[model samples]
Target: MPKIPAMTTYDAHPMHDRVVLITGGAQGVGRGIAQAVLGAGGSVMIGDLDKEAGAACLQEWQVGDRAAFRQLDVSRESSVRRWVDAALARFGRIDGLVNNAGIADPLREPLHTLPLEKWNRYINTNLTGAFLCSKYTLPALNKANGAIINIASTRALQSEPDTEAYAASKGGLVALTHAMAVSVGPSVRVNAILPGWIVTDAWQKPQKRHTPKLSRIDHQQHPAGRVGTPEDIGALAVYLLSSAAGFVTGQHFVVDGGMTVKMQYA
Candidate 1:
């Protein structure tokens, strides 16, 4: 056979042969993580409930057999198990997991006034989802000495108004990361990323338009000069997954641009 061109030959990052499963991969931070994994030459299984958007994301990141999508509702045990099984069937193995599926506090109500049902929904999706996915995929990931990156929020560390459930769920997730790290040691690693002020579609551009103008204080809050983008968090996620971070685990990484550090002055 003639010499194969090196450029045309298959090559990937250190993780090129690895397989990763990302929850909420249809949009925002999840979609960004999928793109990062694709660029690294890794096979990625995107699990999300948004079929239309997930299909679009898969097409956008099409790279031969390197990408796939599965419809998943993380709140349900059956759904989470199904996606994990499907990913293993297609890829034969799993190298890592990014638990990025979560819902914010639907209603901006005071904690005392928050509805029990809404609170349950937030806890189920944000906290319980990670537990279910991790519990089910432990076997496949353990084989590869894989990692788990939970997508937490700065709210887990700090707080704002009307965000009780979101903060609590994320804080619980951070704790969960440490627990898994210790319990799953010598075979697997677990960590969490706390992102601040990321301008996700759901956060920055809601479907319903707001009639009021943003205050100057809102514009001046971030010390980074502008709000964060999904890609910012995605880059960090990629780094944490790579072998470059082999010794790093059981840690919480905050990817905010000094927003949490700054002291608000009147």
Candidate 2:
């Protein structure tokens, strides 16, 4: 099926008056973003490839008329359109969109051994998916003078071995952020945030979820005194979409606990 829906409500929070569309929002980082919006009082139409996760999220936010879920395969143009339509039909209007959909795996295979299908999957889901979501949602966003936050990663700037596909996809998102900021400016703002080491093990669905295994080195390695959280990125997302950052656009923020700035030695 192209789309589906589950509805609820969350009110009188920081984003109390806004309605947003979040992609890949059924688990991990996406789930965090969804919770952030709901916590801030903003309503959301979250989409994801995992139907189980989507169902779970819908049940969790099953309060009133403010929230819903749709199974979305962002890589498919038809799916993207249907998801957007399901949102508009349910919520009446859209105030913002978060292009947070993408495969999270950073495969450790050598470049020579990497399969063509894997590379295509990364590009299609990570880069092309954002393009399609932005293309289809621009009209609604322009109507509301909304914002777009592309969830890039620290890998965009720097990367480890066997991470070429993931890094390239994120880098493309960073580039797309500025390009869209200029193209859709005045009516809509666009920005990208690169999050690093956010421990999302505990944020998954019931069966797959587990306690995070963090160590002293993980906390000490970051300049922020600890690893990052989904809320960190989620909070920035709220700010970027709010009136406070009305003048901000075409910017890239690295929310990596200052890890990118610290010099590393062997």
Candidate 3:
């Protein structure tokens, strides 16, 4: 197994005494968020569908002392509820939730020919899954005066051909983020992060990890001169959950290297 990188230490633990729950926290942006939370002195409950990957991540991060992992299929209410209950049983309090699990396949089949199974899979796993997680975790969040951060995508706003299912699900998530914020306000803060072209292959499970291969043209196209990283979203998530962003809620922060703002003539 590859060694974990040296973690940057912080003098002040912004998330001290806070317990955050993250679905699909075993890899990619979810893993980055989990690491950032730990680095800032917060405990995390990582729920993922891949048990082996989740366990490997917790161990590799050396966050076993401050983290817990549970197998969760966010689309299933039973699984979502069980994960939430287990986190509560172990940590006894919940301060924040990162709804970061979802299928990201860009199935390009025309809607007229799209199978119902394909459509439901994307909607159920992406949109409905967030709904179930939020539903099950909201009570604890309210009791702790906590927050929710939904990991959406720029596809929610704009999309390419054959991206209807994924795009629609993400679009619904954006709407739900604000609706939920309004429904649970005065107690819990809700927000969404729409990350564009974040390269997360390096953050996947060790066995599946690979070095990213991006050409100069790819990096040059973005206004930021490069693609985004999991860390970019992670840092923003931690900040949103912090008291620093206390007055911020029902907002969608886009962290896409400003790619969405650049118009393409081709």
Best candidate according to lDDT: 3
Pairs that clash in candidate 2: 8-64, 8-66, 9-64, 14-40
- Looking at model 3, the pairs that clash are none
Question: Candidate 3, which ten residues in sequence have the lowest lDDT sum?
Answer: 6-15
Residue-pair clashes per prediction, in order, are 0, 4, 0
Scored against the true structure, residue 85 in model 1 reaches a CA lDDT of: 93
Model 3 lDDT per residue over 1-266, tens place:
99999985654778999999999999999999999999999999999999988989877878666899999999999999999999999999999999999997778889889999999999999999999999988989999899999999999988999889999999999999999999999799999999999999899998999999999998999999998889999999999888777899999988999888989898
User: Residue 76: error of model 2 in Å?
Assistant: 0.6
What lDDT would each prediction earn against the true structure? 0.84, 0.90, 0.92
TM-score of 3: 0.95
The number of the candidate with the highest TM-score is 3
| C-alpha TM-score for every candidate | 0.87, 0.93, 0.95
Ranking by TM-score: 3, 2, 1
- Candidate 2 has its poorest 10 consecutive residues by lDDT at 5-14
